[model samples]
Target: MRCIIMSNELTKKAAEMLLNGATLLSEPCPYCKGVRVMKDGNALCVNCGKNLK
Candidate 1:
């Protein structure tokens, strides 16, 4: 029996693509624009889950 393992470089490239494909808002939420926003990790909007950069 033989098994093939993926390389770390390949895994890293895939991860980068996924992250880049995601939407990254440069401005604030229209509803709560100008309000203070914080990063909680992952792709989530600070005001309404709109995805932050």
Candidate 2:
């Protein structure tokens, strides 16, 4: 199976955002167009519970 990996810089940025209570917004979820996405641990999604990335 192929393995997906994240670079150190990307991981660091995500951690920083989480620590500062900040969230990264890339694009809207196809299922939910709602904004104000929040970060749950390493996952990001809108208040509607849609996974953004």
The candidate that wins on TM-score is 2
Model 1 deviation from native, Cα RMSD in Å: 13.4
Clashes of each: 0, 0
Largest lDDT belongs to which candidate?
Answer: 2
lDDT per residue (tens digit) for residues 1-51 in model 1: 111132343334435545666333456556646222333444443333344
**All candidates' TM-scores?**
0.29, 0.32
Tens-digit lDDT string for candidate 2 (1-53): 11123334345555665677877566665565534334664444433443443
lDDT of each: 0.41, 0.49
Candidate 1, run of 10 with poorest lDDT: 1-10
* Backbone steric clashes in candidate 1, count: 0
Model 2, which residues run further than 4 Å from truth? 1-6, 23-53
After superposing candidate 1 on the true structure, give the runs of residues whose Cα lies further than 4 Å from its correct spot: 1-6, 22-53
Sliding window of 10 residues with minimal summed lDDT for model 2: 1-10
